[model samples]
Target: MTPLDKIRNFSIIAHIDHGKSTLADRLIQRTGGLSEREMSAQVLDNMDIEKERGITIKAQTVRLEWKGHVLNLMDTPGHVDFAYEVSRSLAACEGALLVVDAAQGVEAQTLANVYQSIEHDHEIIPVINKIDLPSAEPEKVKTEIEEIIGLDASNAVLSSAKSGIGIDEVLDAIVERIPAPKGDPDAPLKAMLVDSWYDPYLGVVILVRVIDGTIRKGQQVKFMATGTTHLIDRVGAFTPKLENLPDLGPGEIGFITAQIKEVAQARVGDTLTDAKKPAAEPLPGFKEVQPVVFCGLFPVDAADFEKLRESISKLRLNDASFSFEMETSAALGFGFRCGFLGLLHLEIIQERLMREYDLDLITTAPSVVYQIELTHGGGHIDLHNPADMPEPNKIETISEPWIQAVIYVPDEYLGSILKLCQDRRGIQQNLTYVGGRAQATYELPLNEVVFDFYDRLKSLSKGYASFDYEQIGYREGDLVKMGILVNEEPVDALSMIVHRSTAETRGRGMVERLKELIPRHMFKIPIQAAIGGKVIARETISALRKDVTAKCYGGDATRKRKLLDKQKKGKAKMREYGSVSIPQEAFIAALRMGDDA
Candidate 1:
């Protein structure tokens, strides 16, 4: 059982809930890498949010030393928002063990990660996980994996990570096949921060793979991006548990702690090297992540805004993917303007913030970007945010984001789903029957998918359909600008883009919805949709004059005026376009509606 010669650096990749963590647990135990006292049902799910949501939001690394070869195992987040995190995990590995669910087969995220693995030029070993399920059909899954992931799965390791069935085969397969990381162990210092976290006690704990040279405790190191160098205080590896490694070099994965207090200090792609003898260059290839879904997140109580801000700051330090900014709206009050990888990413973040930070928040609906057209004099200007929306009678054309969607559903519900797509303004392209199901492709507006898209899919397919999409670029479609006017003033946040075909429908629905959501005020609210200054659709919220007449409590009236002043102050912060007080949530919620039509 010699250590260096048999070491294998591999990561388990899968789509969300495909059981990457469960498989990790079995491998750690099967390799005799951990004791009974150390093994838990899902030992790798160290965070409370992950355990509860049953999803891995962060990447975790552990080592299984077997037959003298140390097999470094990294588990990655299966969701797309964590795709960047997945890429970071891949950078630290020499090979990837793709775990395909035998029953569910391949998904969009599966393709995403496979593309990522190929992009990294990783050696991939396919493993057919979840083979114990009644729906499990290993041969079908194998073929699909090979077809979709463009990988060889002929000798796929079939196993149930839960019962530990055939788990040893998966381990031996990695040892026999996956090669050790190839790098100059004696070269100048260079390392990759695969994933990291902020330990209240230990500061920024980084999981790094030393590509060359060596790093040890108290060594002054430079972080390539932040330029905030620090002296390493501790170095260790997860031998299924924290076993301090004196130093890390080529072909090994381990943890190192710095006196640095924040996750920002240890940027994932930053190269760690001795300032005196740095590597010729850091490992190339790091991408800036952009959030797809934007929404307003606020504490129900204004006092908790600061608390929510602190929580998000701490959380983002560990998760570079999580992004947010302070935002306030007359309709939604004060909260953080947060961006997510997508819808699921949005949900998981909200849930984590609530569960971990223990803050109750009001989340406004989500929205997508709209192309605004402002016709000032004889010229025109296009805008993406409502803040840039044109004033009434001065706008000529407006556009919304669009997409080309492909939905895969069961044969039984094929007809129903097709009809649903058509109803949502989707131009059906082709329907191919694959195996016993149908893969339906269509060109749909991104605005359509921003709202009710998921719910519609579930309804039409009876919940058996699955799909994914990439921005195919926008078209000069029939989109229109709609406004929700409050007190004869347009709220910038509420100015939005809608398909011209549905502009009236959206205007009416949003007005009605807003009227219900908005509290009675001293003024009437009008929700309207206009095409070239033609008011095609409109809704109004009647003003209410409910003043307490209980002797107008002398000093209490002053307190009431202060509260009214605060509310007015809040409303004024929002961008004004026309007469609509469109809150941030209304903007986001409309797009997140996921209803293409």
Candidate 2:
């Protein structure tokens, strides 16, 4: 098998909105992946939220041609939440296009991704994008990159993906900076499954990079998992254009359509090869991703519980990022508590679960790992799901997870930002001025930032600040229990833990907000607060049955359940004992109250 003489493997990696997708649009247009008449910005990011949020969530690959060589170009999710997917994208490539914003310099995520690329030994080519903006300062950013990353940023090419200025240099830089895939074409099969897509009509479409050997149509190949064998239904490559080929040799990526009975057989890191000739041992150094954010996913209708479980299983087959287990809820009926990487990851998984699989889901508030003690043992441990939490007085110390956050803002807003972060229990680490902008780094609990932190920061900064962080180790901090009561009785469902310093102010505001979000009930809904089993404050939720029993329509007298559900949406029910029914929305309001308080 001759080397295709025409193929380069590289991917663009960057922080969100650092112009990776915009640069990809420009690169594809100039390199013949798409023509000017066919161009649209952020084409690789086709998801609705990706378009709305202006960030890439899934890794997308496209074919591009330049200087007589075909470049298998890839654009990957840049946010910290999807870092595992980013890692897989990097492992499949030989080089990376590290894009940085001209005005913002190197962000926290930029460094994290750059390190992920380096771990895979990717040849990194730095590109400064957004040079077209009025505040663009490529020179200052170049120095920041050099000092922070120790990269030769002085030689970094400045380009405006929007204006198409100096775009050619970036392409030339990739060819010169990135290495070509090399291997013995005549060797036995060993291809890396880099990416995958599903077509409801076509089953699963597999994307593979031929590290070595060849795969041909009608040949028997065994998927690493399931040991299931299938005929290579078809073989094809893209010269920025789909071209049918009998077979693909070393250094090329092509699509394969196999009779994949299940997605379990077509995982991203799985290897594909001739049945008799397997790789030395599925390429080393790949790890399964673990979820960091946990939440309960209940169906609005209890009858949909099994259907929700089935949908989650089907979704997990296609998405290696999401994880779940069948669970039962006294209030939520039968449901599943799912875990994700973070807020963005949770949003994508939830949206895709509903939109793609078509399930009506009611999600509980997202939470981080909570250290709990077992009543039976002297040992302490970590709990990612609330369902796993032990009964209230299991003997010992408990701590919530924490993170180290770095926020960047303009110099003028430094004072206000500092005050705001401090109110959230952030321990200021350092403050610095980079390229004339102020950056404040702090160590804060992951729980503190889980709700409305982004919204609060934007409101304070007039929408000019950006922040990112990773889970730092946790330490036992001053803790307090926040109890939300209905009719002056504490409801276990609405109880939450908080920093002790914030109990009175933050806790009161939280329970009060719950009073508003929880629906009016058959009886009056009173949202109250308690500390150590003693009620401290109270707020009332109006009673339901708005028009009373006299206003029922002629045929609608039997629709009591429908009316109850709708009415309960705004209220809580106080029971005869110390029990209360806290509506689902109240569960969410308790978390968000900290933002304003």
CA lDDT, every model vs. true structure: 0.73, 0.75
lDDT of 1 by residue, 435-486 (tens): 7777788887766675567787887777678766666664666555566565
Poorest 10 consecutive residues of model 1 by lDDT? 573-582
lDDT of 2 by residue, 469-502 (tens): 8788767866656666667654554566667777
Residue 61 CA displacement from its true place in model 2, Å: 1.2
Query: Could you tell me every candidate's TM-score relative to the true structure?
Result: 0.82, 0.82
Candidate 1, superposed: residue stretches over 4 Å from native: 1-4, 368-385, 388-406, 415-432, 440-447, 470-481, 486-494, 515-534, 540-597
RMSD of each: 8.1, 7.6
* CA shift of 331, model 1, Å: 3.0
